[model samples]
Target: MTSININKEKFGQLIHKEKPVLVDFWAPWCGYCRRIGTAYEKISEEYSDILIAGKVNIDEEPQ
Candidate 1:
């Protein structure tokens, strides 16, 4: 399964779900974040049956 794009409005809801969630709060311009992104997604798919993986782009929703 693919990781979900978590916007600010739905962040709280996603975290509160019964199935545990893993959230990656990252910025597109950050090299380290970008470097690990592909690995993270692969992990998401691998564990999707037991958990939910989501990502938040801090640059898009800076508040």
Candidate 2:
């Protein structure tokens, strides 16, 4: 399963889910964040059956 694109508007709803949620808070321009992109994708799919994997782009969703 693909990771959900999370934003502030949807964050509240995602957190209230019965299932566990894993959120990756990142920024596009961060070098370290880019390094883990593939690994995160793999993990998202691996655990998708039990929990929801979400990615929040800090640049776009910074509060």
Candidate 1 per-residue C-alpha lDDT over 1-63 given as tens digits, one digit per residue, 9 for 90 to 100: 989998988888887888898989999789999999999999999999989999989888775
**What's model 1's TM-score?**
0.88
Task: State the lDDT of candidate 2 residue by residue for 1-63, as single tens digits.
Answer: 979899987889988999898999999899998899889999999988999999999989987
The lDDT, on a scale of 0 to 1, for candidate 1 is: 0.90
lDDT (CA) for every model shown?
0.90, 0.91
Q: Which parts of model 2 are misplaced by more than 4 Å? A: none
Clashes of each: 0, 0
Q: What is the lDDT of residue 36 in candidate 2?
A: 94
User: In model 1, which runs have C-alpha deviations exceeding 4 angstroms?
Assistant: none
